[model samples]
Target: MNSAEVLSSDLDLVRRSLLVQKSEILNKHMEFKNLQHSSAKATDEADAVVQDLQDNLNIQLHERDQFSLLLIDKALSKFADGTYGLCECCADVIDVRRLKARPLATLCIACMEDQEAPGKHLFQ
Candidate 1:
């Protein structure tokens, strides 16, 4: 497909991803707050563990929301400049499969592979 078509699709996906992230962040914030409030009332180790899990989830959700915001901003800027498919790392056309999977991606598969290789534990 053409660059214009790819950019259009990427923008649409970025918009959807931002919306979903907003909702998820809000929900996670609420859950974390509730857990914090009730944690003092926790009577057993199980409740403490659950509260700890909720705290961890809140941190993860916040990080993901931040990442989503950054990706959205980058994608919008790229769309405006008509260079969305050009890899930020190498200025080459990103593979279609990679772009389809990560619509807001600013780097090509090769660059992404290098970035990911050094951070395998960060993924999950």
Candidate 2:
């Protein structure tokens, strides 16, 4: 088909991928919550230390999953507003390959590189 059709198809794919990721994250989060609630109390000092470390790791994982969900939601919102695949900084269309690789990416490669450059200032 034409360019518009191709872009639309790509966006649809990205949207589907994002939704799948969101669902997976939600399911994992639920499982984590259940596991946390059902965890047995430590009976010894060594067990307590191990449990504390495990709890810390679980919290970090939960936070990471939360952040991923937020990014996925933001990307889905962009799709709703007809702005998916557009760079947030330069307003240029982001490469479909990049989007396919990182569905939550909001910047084109050039803008991303610029932002990551040393001594670069980011406003807001």
Candidate 3:
């Protein structure tokens, strides 16, 4: 097919993947919520401590999942706006490998590295 068809197909694939991931993350967050509530019934001192640690871990995991879900949502919006495969910072096409690795990515490797670079002065 043509380039437009190929891009449409790729965006469809990305959309499907992100929807599946979003569902899975929501399910896990629900499970974590249930676990957190159930842990309040821990009786033994050791059990309570263990439960606390588990709760903390669950909270951290849920927060990361939430952030991922938000990114996926933003990516979906980009797709709607016909800018799915383009880098947000430089407006160039993002690498396919990077998109495959992180479908929700909005930046290309160079832009991402620049954003992540440490010790850069604000003025320069």
Cα-lDDT of candidate 2: 0.90
Q: Count the backbone clashes (under 3 Å) in each candidate.
A: 0, 0, 0
> Which candidate do you rate higher for lDDT, 2 or 3?
2
What is candidate 2's CA lDDT for residue 97? 91
lDDT, residue 70, model 1? 75
Off by over 4 Å in 3: 116-124
Candidate order (TM-score): 2, 3, 1
Instruction: Provide the lowest-lDDT 10-residue window in model 3.
Output: 115-124
How do the residues 1-124 of candidate 2 rate in per-residue lDDT, one tens digit apiece? 9998998898899899899999999999898888778777667999889888999999999999989989999999999999988999999999999999989999999999998887777544
Per-residue alpha-carbon lDDT of candidate 1 for residues 1-124, written as tens digits (9 for 90 to 100): 9987976776567656655765776777677677677676767999779877877887787788767767767776776777877898899987756766777777888888878797675875
Residue 29 CA error for candidate 2 (Å)? 0.5
Compared with the true structure, the alpha-carbon lDDT of candidate 3 equals 0.83
Between candidates 1 and 2, the lDDT winner = 2
* Tens digit of per-residue lDDT, candidate 3, span 1-124: 9986986677688778988988998888888778777667899999989888887888788789889989988887887888888988999999766786789888999998988888665747
How high is the lDDT of residue 60 in model 2?
Answer: 96
lDDT of each: 0.73, 0.90, 0.83
